[model samples]
Target: MRLSDISIKNPVFAWMLMFGLMIFGLISFSRMGVSQMPDVDFPTVTVSVSLDGAAPEVMETQVVDPIESSLMTVEGIESIKSSSKTGSASITVEFDLDRNIDLAVQDVQAKISGIQRMLPDDVDPPSISKTNPDDQPILWLALTYDKEDPEFLMRYARDYLKDRFTTVEGVGDIFLGGYTDPVMRVHVRPKDLLRYNISVNDVVDAIRNEHSELPGGYIQTDKKTFNVRTMGEAKTEEEFRNIVISRRAGVTVADPTNMVKIRQVADASMGLDKIERMSRFNGKTALGLGIRKQRGTNAVSVARAVKEQITVIQKTLPPGMNLQVNFDSTKFIEQSVGELNHHLILAVIFTSLVCWMFLGSWSATFNVLLSIPTSLLGAFIGLYFLGYTLNTFTLLGLTLAIGIVVDDAIMVLENIFRYNENGRGRIESAILGAREISFAAMAATAAVIAIFLPVAFMKGIIGKFFMQFGVTISIAVFLSLVESLTITPMRCAGFVHHGERKTKLGKGFEALMENTRIGYDRWLRVSLQHPWKVLIGSLVFVAVSFISIKFLNKEMSPAQDQSIFMARLIMPVGTSLQYTDQQTKKRKRGSCPVRKSNRCMQPWGALVAVFLIPT
Candidate 1:
């Protein structure tokens, strides 16, 4: 027996099955991650190495060259690019799309390890990480303090707020921008060094030797053992200045007159660490807290959790300190998803209205509309199991599927209604009509699946991006086919009535459809009489469409208004940070007259400044 025949015989079974699917789909949807785009792991890895005081030329030859050469032997590498900059080197390797990112990372790491010993000894260990676009920060916050001490914000962020934010669920990492630690700096006078005939290394060795705590041997007694330690680290600027560097040969231990001390040659004081980068919010110096979410997590959920945590943190903050949001990336995602949802609902409503106008029966329209939700909701189950997110691509697929999913239902309903109009009972007509149209419905569904299924398995980066889109539409269509054969037939047999009362609007729609049918028949007869002319016209239309393709605008995605604008400023090579900051300020002043608007200007040591203007 056909599935539809079984569902009609046992109507209870069909209802239970529909309810079960709806329940499971809802549960799966609640657990699925939400983001702006599909989660695609790019087959790329980056290796970064650092060496203190190393020039770009030295880093290129010693670090980047050796690393790139070693990585060349790794399998599936599409391309390799390297950048050598002051004190650092970076290498990026992109693998074939079919390559697994995890396996590729391991292969790259093995190659780097093999060449580690051959590289310069002073080069720091290379850090390796996979490339993922979703790994970027989802939210940014600016911290400001009214206190005069510049180091207070950095210290607070490092010691307290960072740890607190790290504990939040879904938070992967917390990065502090424009952060500098406190350190004791020693400035040596070149004249004093020449007079004493002492090299710069001598003073460095003296401080390294004295500014440390050393382990002392234990003194064991008869019944107890005591551990001891020597505390020799300098606790103040004066103590660091007093550290002895050298002494004359004839100097006595009790007399310090012949001793050469740090105070005599250098000035020591506590100050901020070397400033390589700076961050400002609304033209005020501030520390930025950038929060990154873990892989495969929901961006919206993570942002919500962080905001709730911020609310709690506000109560515990000290006086004269303020925390404000600088930028949020999830706001756009939420709004876009919300808009797509609205579109999806409208599509369903319009599709049902069209079906009602043609069918001219409320019961038939109701049965057809049932299939739309049943198919869409059931698709969520498949998406969840496939590890897909409800992102733009998948949601767009669902929206487009709204039109296609109703095809099977409309075919079955129209056939069953025709049988009933021929004087057969509803139950007998439904069974025979559904059975007759079953093979045709399956064939139509198969045609659509054939077109989209290949897209899901396409080989390339583009395939990866659209895989979810194709699979989502295929799942919705397949589910609709099942519903048409099962629930749709069962409902038509039991609930759908023949010769139901029609309103005036429904009568008018029926008249309009009859006129359209008459017009179509007249055109069909005319075309049959002039087959040669019809063929030529159709050929001309196809040729025109093909020629017009060149005039169409093609792009990966359409431009969107994100409510923010950014400008990048690049200075000449070797420009100092101070000069870059000055230039950025000049550009900021010249570009916009509204000083009260929120602005974020970040300048790094490479003489690059990024200015963000939020609308």
Candidate 2:
């Protein structure tokens, strides 16, 4: 049978089948994770290593150089850069865009480990950290309290907060900074070391030996084992002072005649000391919390997890202490996504209403609505496959698409109705109407998709962010056109029936369209007869539009909706006393009066030479 014969025979069954397809399409969309922007990962990796007794130059030569040089031989490694600071070395390796990070890291590790014995003894093994900046902290918080001490905050964060939310499925890690415990410091004077003929190494050994408590060898007297130990260790500074260094019997190293005593050379003490200052928030001493999301994880989901954990821990915080969020990507993502979603729904609803009004049949409306869900689902499926996202570009394209997708449906349905009015049977009209314009719809969709191809080819950061959107919408619109030509025609053919009747509203709509065409005919006739007037009027309109663009203040999208709006006026535009009086009257109602509070702003205040901020 011909394609037309199939559509004419069973259009409603075809409609039902398409509905089932839409349900499957919904399943495809559900598998997608939500994010604010296009999902992509840069190809980069970092090696972190610690070096003891090394300055920056020494660290660069001893640790950073060896690692970077070794990794340089790894295949597909693009660029290798290293930073050597006080006691640590970080070497970042960037790879080509197509390189797999996991494989690259494995290759680097295998090569470095094979040459392990060659590295210095004091250099700890280098750790390959995943280099995606998307996995970096998406949220930052400042925790502050008056009564809580640094030790208390430090203990609370470590014991209760950091691990709880960080363990959430998509959360990478949570870091707490600013507050640290005072560490135990053992400072020994250099004079004491010389006085006792003891070196710094000896003092270090003494401290290490005195602080530890360990079990010694067991004794086997009477078949009952007993453990022995050397007990005179320092529990406090006083105890360390009395820790005997040399015996009165002249127990000497290398058989020396010098006798040693505990007080002969050095003063040693155990006390707590602060080593490094930490970062503070807003000029106030407070602990900062940073939350990182796992790679390929949902930003919004991890943020929600952090909040839930914070809620549970809020009860345990010291009085007046709280975690205040300073930065949250989720806020902007949720807002922007929510607005786009709202617009999508409104567009769909408005389009559906318009379609129903024009068709005046419930069955026709239902069939048109079927394409809405299917188009969106198919778009998401394409996105999932291609790694695109529902970001600004994709959404804007979808918004632009609200009118295009339904054009085929409207045209096909209208033609079908037109055939029905010609006294042909329902099945015959369905077949003829669908066959007539399927090619035209396909061509228009091709044009739409073609417009975005150049957008996909755009370069740099801006291009990277918007390319996913461009490709997603491009593919979606093309698929929609195909579906409209193929699936839509098949369904419309089968659903049309012998007994179907046109509503009065549809007939009226047809009459209005007829009247509009007649009006256009008259306007064209008048314009063609007066070419000079037409040319002059068009020129005037163009000039006015140019002037508007030059003078008016415009923004790309709508600002937040509110009951009030404000305008700031500077040394600008011509006005009259009547306009100024009107503006003053308006300000008296709802606007706050602007105050110039700086004494320097006064003309007679000696005009002090001060640069508050360099111009």
Q: Which candidate comes out best when scored by lDDT?
A: 1
Q: Alpha carbon lDDT of residue 91, candidate 1?
A: 95
Worst 10 residues of 1 by lDDT: 247-256
Name the TM-score of candidate 1.
Answer: 0.91
Q: Each candidate's lDDT (Cα)?
A: 0.87, 0.65
RMSD for all candidates, in order, please.
3.2, 12.1
Candidate 2 segments whose C-alpha is farther than 4 A from its true place: 2-16, 24-31, 48-53, 88-90, 111-120, 178-183, 206-277, 281-284, 318-321, 349-369, 381-390, 393-397, 436-467, 485-487, 490-615
- Tens-digit per-residue lDDT, 543-614, candidate 1: 999999999999867899987878788889899988888887788776544455565645355578887766
Candidate 2 collision pairs: 10-494, 11-494, 11-495, 12-495, 192-265, 196-265
TM-scores for every predicted model? 0.91, 0.66
Number of backbone clashes in candidate 2:
6
Worst ten-residue run, lDDT, model 2? Answer: 599-608
* Candidate 1 clash pair list: none
